[model samples]
Target: MALSLKLRQGLVSFFLLLLLLPSSFVAIEQAFYTQLLTNAEQKLEVHLYAILSELSMREDKIELTNNALAPDFYRPDSGISAYINDEQRLLWQSDSSLNQQFELPNVELIPGQHLFHLVSQQQNFWVLSIALLFDAGEQTFPLTIHIVQAEQMLLLPHQSFKRTLLQWFIGIGIGLLALSLLAYYWTTAPLTRLDQEIRKLEQGKQEQLNLSYPSELKVIKEDLNLLLANQNRQKQRYRNHLSDLAHALKTPIAVLNTSALSQQPELKEQLDRITAMIEHQLKRASSSGQDIWKKELPVRPLLDKLTGALHKIYRDKACPISIDCPEHIQFRGDETDLMEILGNLLDNACKACQHQVKLTVTDKPFCLIVEDDGPGIAEHKRQQLFNRGTRLDTYKEGHGVGLSIVAELVSSYSATITISDSPLGGARFTLQFPLEQ
Candidate 1:
């Protein structure tokens, strides 16, 4: 079974969110907490100043005449608490702190300068303190206001806010996930359609793929269409070859029925022409082209196997086959196609070699250049070398199908094959594949 591209993409998206979303949630939570604390502090400052305003000057002695500035100041066990100090002496404390015992934070007196801190007493609390200086009848006195808020003041509001914030985070997280999934579906919709079309093709549910796809998938669609076209061409070629063979054999078969084709001089010549034509068509019919789904062919191992086999056959001649091929270099095609191609080339080169034949494979062009130190092919003959059964040397024991099949393969891969003279005074077949992306 083929791997699902959708499943692979889904996993990739999930991992990306897992790596990023939590950190975003954490940052939001911290910012929310900080903002909540800031708002609470601002409200406390208002109360701190109001208390100082309640102080009344009496007999040149400052007195806090209004203890009822806020109901919490009078209420017992209220989350809000306050105290007043005249210079270094204590003047008053809120009724809320009557039952609780804790040290109050010191006050500051840079005019409007105020201070706040958190401390643990009978319970944890936030303490805000401020100092005010009053002058009456040439007399100056120092007054400080301390506001004590029990932990409930902070905790209660925070818990309420926390619940709301958490709800939002969870809701947003779900919404974000949903959006991500939606975006993925939309983005890969064309691919999903293409996949279905391909499946339909494989199952024979459809005659040909005609699904509308995105621009990015156009190449894939084109390639598939090309495969179908090639298959159709093969069937067409088979029919045409059969028809031609039937027409061609009609005269020969009619003559052979009347006279022995081998014994009769004219019939024997006709038989040779018929046989050569059949062989030519058969060679073309055999090429099936590159496989629709091809596997990579490793350079070194394949070359080693081919060369090792070739060396044994030509062992008496002592023709050395040298290969300069990288282990990791690979041919992206059918293993059989590769074997057929290299086998024919190597066999011919080994047969033609005097002493040394060299095979060099490289990835830059994904090519194999085979060279032999034998009598080189002439320029005029090189053009016809890839023509079926057109051997330059008829005595060389070959039907000359090797280079022609190679020509067909090169055409399929959109590759180039050039035969030239080698420095070793022999033929150099440069079969270059397109560079792998």
Candidate 2:
């Protein structure tokens, strides 16, 4: 079935070696054995020619038919057997151990000149034959000689050669396998370290990832660092913009409040109108600041801090503020952004309620619910309550900016806010945020 990386690589290399190596080795070995056999036959031919020459000298005759040279003339410790003949008869023969095992071919007695032949008998013995010509004073005599040798002796060295080649193949294959494993580990180590660094970056454990890898991965490391730097710069710019906007709105708001305290009847009404307009603008500026800063605040802590501050501020009214929020439940918006949202909604609820306010934080899908026991808004006017400066009670101290601010903060954070009748016979506000952002 399925092969791992190391085994797959090893098997591919081994098969590739098999494809190219064995045929070449076999071709070379066969050529070497053929050459050895040929050289041995040539040496035997030379010895037979020398014996013919000696026989001609003694008899002073050109014809070898009546010459007395023995057929065993070239016998030696090398186990060579010899035979001599003319075109007519079997003249002489050698008595070697191989003579009884094979029938030597009559290649030399075939009535030809310079003929040679090699034959095998019972697949075990090799016979070599050659035709000869001798000159005695311008008269030539034709003679034929035959030699036979055992096939086992000629084939001995070839078997040993094959075994030696097998051993060499095994040794080389093992050496290559060891080298491949070492190379694989050396090459993959740096890549493994880079993987670990990337995981740490994903978990937000590190501000930047650094890795020392080979030349090919250097560009990847540089690109990641550059991306992190750009994100940090964007966050800083958003924070600076919110601070500048808040600073610009504070002085105008103070001047309008001072003018509202003046005593001339006509001026007082104009000053009051100016103060109301200034307060509406100030609430818009405050909500805008929270929108910009909300990206840094988590959800649970912001709700806790808001409920605590509202309870303290409304203590003289004897209204109870109940909070139900889970610990460590974080949100994507900034702290000031959530503060502005919850603070305005709770302040309005406290002012409307005669005795009790309830705030519930459910962790299931990140929802905030606020309810109060007071005179609730009429059903027909609930839709207009979010409009700027739309106060139902003219005697209330605020310029009706609280609900409008709540609406704007919720919109900026991409959160949903809804108004409904409370179970306590007053208004209920529910805000919901997506957990995954």
Name the top lDDT candidate. 1
- Cα lDDT tens digits, model 2, 1-437, are 11244456656766766765677677867887887688767866675665566554235423344434444443443455666666765555554533355554655244454444456566555556667664556766666667655666667877777788768866876676667657755665566677667656644457676757778778887886887677667766755665675577667655765774556677666666666676555545544333222232346666667777877888789898887777765555545556767887788888889999999877556688999998987889887888877887655477666678778777766778888999999999898866643
- Where is the poorest 10-residue window by lDDT in model 2? 288-297
Each candidate: what lDDT? 0.75, 0.66
Q: Model 1 segments beyond 4 Å from truth? A: 1-35, 56-62, 86-89, 106-111, 117-124, 136-138, 172-189, 203-205, 211-227, 242-284, 287-437
**Which candidate comes out best when scored by TM-score?**
1
TM-score for all models, in order of appearance: 0.51, 0.45
In the predicted model 2, the residue pairs found to clash are: 294-333, 294-334, 295-334, 296-334, 297-333, 297-334, 297-335, 299-331
For candidate 2, the TM-score is: 0.45
Residue lDDT tens for model 1, 96-171: 7787676765545665567777776667878777766766567777777778777676677667776777788778
Model 2 / residue 234 / CA error / Å: 5.7
Candidate 1: 10-residue stretch with minimal lDDT = 286-295
